[model samples]
Target: MRFFCIALAAASCAFADGVGIAFPQENALLPAVKRTYVIGAIPAADATQPLTIAGVTNDVYKTGAFIAMVPVEGGTNTITLTWGTNTLDRTFRVAFPSPPKPAATNTPPRDVRKDLGIPPDEEVSDARPKGKRIEDLTVMIDPGHGGQDTGALMPHGAGEKTVNLLQAQAIEAEFAKYGIKTVMTRTTDDEFPALYARPRRAYAEKVDAFISVHHNSTAADRDPREVRHTAAYASTPNGLALAKAIQQYVGPQVTGVKNAGAQMRSYAVCRNPAVASCLLEIDFINLPEGEDAALNDADRRSRIAHAVLIGFLDWLFAPDDGT
Candidate 1:
């Protein structure tokens, strides 16, 4: 009897190998906005037993698979899957959504011109560098997403990868005119490197600055045309300065693009400690106008490229900081 029990236990272990929880990964941070589906593959040996998950009985199919819609409340929720004596479980957090801000008022905004302490007729000084040159600087340009990763695909069939490569190429061309050396993470549409690998190239090349180009997307319910903004992101303080420079120049150069300002974000490419880095969201690709400006129009692409080059030059030669 003891020898027979040992053989049965070994068989159970082999069957357990086929059982797995595929979705709502172990110790995952799940969004609390809506109920999520818990999907998994069940072993045929455990198919006869009732599968209890978080007090709910889940129905398993003959094909040894199961899918259940689980309501996730805010805070930690322990999910337990049990089939007879064999059990599998995982703990995950359902984060609380941030509170919505108050709606904007209809009143006209107050003018802050009085706070400038300058006469309205006085001429503003030129912000561009006069004699500074970046001939010795080497910049690394990253065109975000490519190949299998077609990021932010619009319903109209526009892909962000195409625009990213186009913009990166144009930027490279403009930088060459200033005698500044430039390198790209990807020069073609079919090449896609891992996220960390993109910034690692900058360190390997010993470049002074890194910029990743990308386009923006909106929620499914919102109309893309209603929201068109140009934004820049950086992780470090020096990177923030570069982001600000890009925002200041590229925002206006893109014609219809609204200046969303520079934001500090800890993105993978922007977190490289060895080089100053920023990610530029040139335009919203989902919208018709943005699609025309960012991808379809050659003149707009050239203008944006020139604007980015000018922004980098401004950052490199800013009188107040040590670049």
Candidate 2:
């Protein structure tokens, strides 16, 4: 495969590798994220043959193959991929923008994809045949709470909704660079989605993956049972894997991210098997600090989005971490 190699030595030497897998500003995958990246080396003489990568499909990658990743949709996922004895023995994460919320459409459209220097457009038909494209995928980002329902007020005066939308837009930019299709749950700052309607949209869109993005609140009035580390919930076996991927990937990338792990909830949106579903409760929005940080800064936000992307890719093309 002709990868748009990022020329590792060429990227602007970046900050300390504080986050998950660190890359200089020019990793090939980051730049041409929309298209698959074939990150491989000639199998070492000792390397295993018919090398297999199994995390995502629970199957194997053909022999003498390079790893491929598609970063169109944003969400964390876990999968086990192996390539013989000489394998990609590690967890890989692709940075994707966050799911959209009801108010983001109006947040001053910014071309995040451009800022990131992601790959340019070269249209190609989705490899997925028709109906299976049901799994073909469309991301429905739901940034919980809006005009009336304050998702969780951040300390520095940022609203959870704002953070959700901002992150969603960022994720969208990443997806666009790869030519992935997407649908936002909302684009305005005016109304709140009905509690029930939020998940309903994914079902209607036939979204292959559904994600609800919202920061939690420590509201005394809010459910006291809500405070926890980074939490995710899913609907099926695949969904559980996805949640595990996110939790595992995000913890390494974000400084304060706590692993809430995966659980099956009775959420209406998560129950549908047609699409893989997850709700990411990122930190306590009610905390004055989380609120401020979720917004205001671009780099931190970038890390969050990147973590999700990496987690999703890890799940989709999960690397074999020799247990």
Candidate 3:
């Protein structure tokens, strides 16, 4: 009986070959997922080396090794592993619990304008047509595509407008954290104001800068391969500086997403009241390769959103950064 037990133990060890994995994968999930992945073997041994873990966040990685998988988002996905020449396969399933959204920061108790030497434009800045210049500046964020207009729709029904609004909200939260004055075009699920009206409100409020958040869609005939790229359009000629800064910062953060560069578009806000203005068409819409899903993902997309906010603030305070 002892010898039989020993033989069984050795057999079990010999067959323990591989494992599988998914990405954005591990723990903590969000509604949007970037990609689904499969990792075949962990700690692989062929002509021979030890196995190492490989994934987006994992520190360890090996060419032919894989082990254990934790789900980040989406439903329970199964990974099949085939072992060696015999082509034996093993499967495992995991539950993916949705990660909680980040909490929004509360408004500061006091405004920063008091220390900046410029008077606050409080509501009616019409009296001072010249506009106030503060050490810190005020910005208005407008999210394009709202209400019944779904903008562009992906195969999975991800909407560009929805992404824009969410991106706008995430950026505003960050701007508030830095004590910059901010005005928003619309906050809820209401119809967006007409194109011309958007900048009018910003100009009326004496906003220092106006940013319009939107997504651009390309025609399938020309872009059959489903191109993914980031771009910015400036109404004011001077606003190109802001556009370039945003493209430089936000583009790399999105990874595989391309940069269309700072483009010049004659927009409604460019000629309005001399306030600098820019429009950002984040990426091509309804891309077949889950581009919308990637942008909608809170973990990754929020980083892009935060980057846009940082680019503007960085431009405002550190224009001398030698872009």
Candidate 4:
């Protein structure tokens, strides 16, 4: 398989002693269960060496093939394999499905797909064949705020929540063209999940990436029209790659959109340690020009979304650990 071939090639550069990862392959996405195991092999001559994984050294086999079980954490988990003087590590995500929340007054949860003008039947369509790069990858798209949370409103009363949803839908459609599956936190203007639930939903889906779409706003006391910058935030290094990709690929596509650049922030959506995530402020909607471009222009929204798509592709194909 391609995964094994790539993994073997990676193992080769790190060691010439015939050490390799045989199972759970590299960059494997595992279920978010309580415990999981990793399997790999080393030279039979060196099988007697004590091997440690994620700090657990017991249960490691001495028959060349080594297997160790470790506890799973929500979001992303890095498993480190160390033996003798060499060490190898792989990063993977563990996403447990979100448990059903009790319905208020016995009412079922709202189905926002229909409200968002998306036919429920069209939610999962396999007619569009998957692309090789994004196949088996999932991205959770969170539209910043909804319902009562209007977010940053323009002077003309244009709501930031609406613009966020519009841009998210456009981005989701672009990702769809590449056969990538996407999950949305809120599909309609009326739907509103709690602030913390946004990223939590991404973790539950074990999504490969999490992106929160929002428009920036300045203090009400200051002129909102003065800000006209595009900013992206990330917490992890991999997340930063995603952030920078957007800044590099999408920032220039929008008129008057200055690349404020990608930054590190503790925002709730991308703050999870396990998920590679980014939060994008395409433009400051409070600025008249920014609002017109980001909120009203369909072509501009599409271009920005396309740029983000390109950025993600760049990150996925980038070299890993100098490999």
lDDT by residue (268-318, candidate 1, tens digit) is 888766678899998876544555566668888888888898888778778
**TM-score per model over all chains:** 0.59, 0.52, 0.55, 0.57
User: Residue 202's C-alpha lDDT in candidate 2?
Assistant: 58
TM-score of 3: 0.55
The runs of at least 3 residues in candidate 3 whose Cα sits more than 4 Å from the true structure, single-residue gaps closed, are 1-136, 224-226, 290-295, 318-323
Candidate 3 backbone clash number: 8
The TM-score obtained by model 2 is 0.52
Q: What's model 1's overall lDDT?
A: 0.72
Candidate 2's residue-wise lDDT over 1-323, tens digit each?
11122224433122112211111112222321332222232223313444343334221112121333423323332222343322233333345644555664567743322332323462311111223332355666777667877565442333577888876777666665655567877776556777656655555555656667767654222322244467778756666666667666556357365666667665554554445667777665443334445665667666766677676655656544210
**Lowest lDDT 10-residue stretch of candidate 4:** 123-132
Q: List clashing residue pairs in candidate 1.
A: none
lDDT of 3 at 39: 31
**Can you write out model 4's per-residue Cα lDDT over 1-323, one digit (the tens) per residue?**
22222233444344433245543445656555666545456555556778788897744334355545567776777777766666677676776667878766977754433333334465331111124356788888889999999887653354689999999999999999999899999999998898767766665565778889999876423444345678899866767877887778766556456788898887766665556789998887654455557766899888888888887777667665211
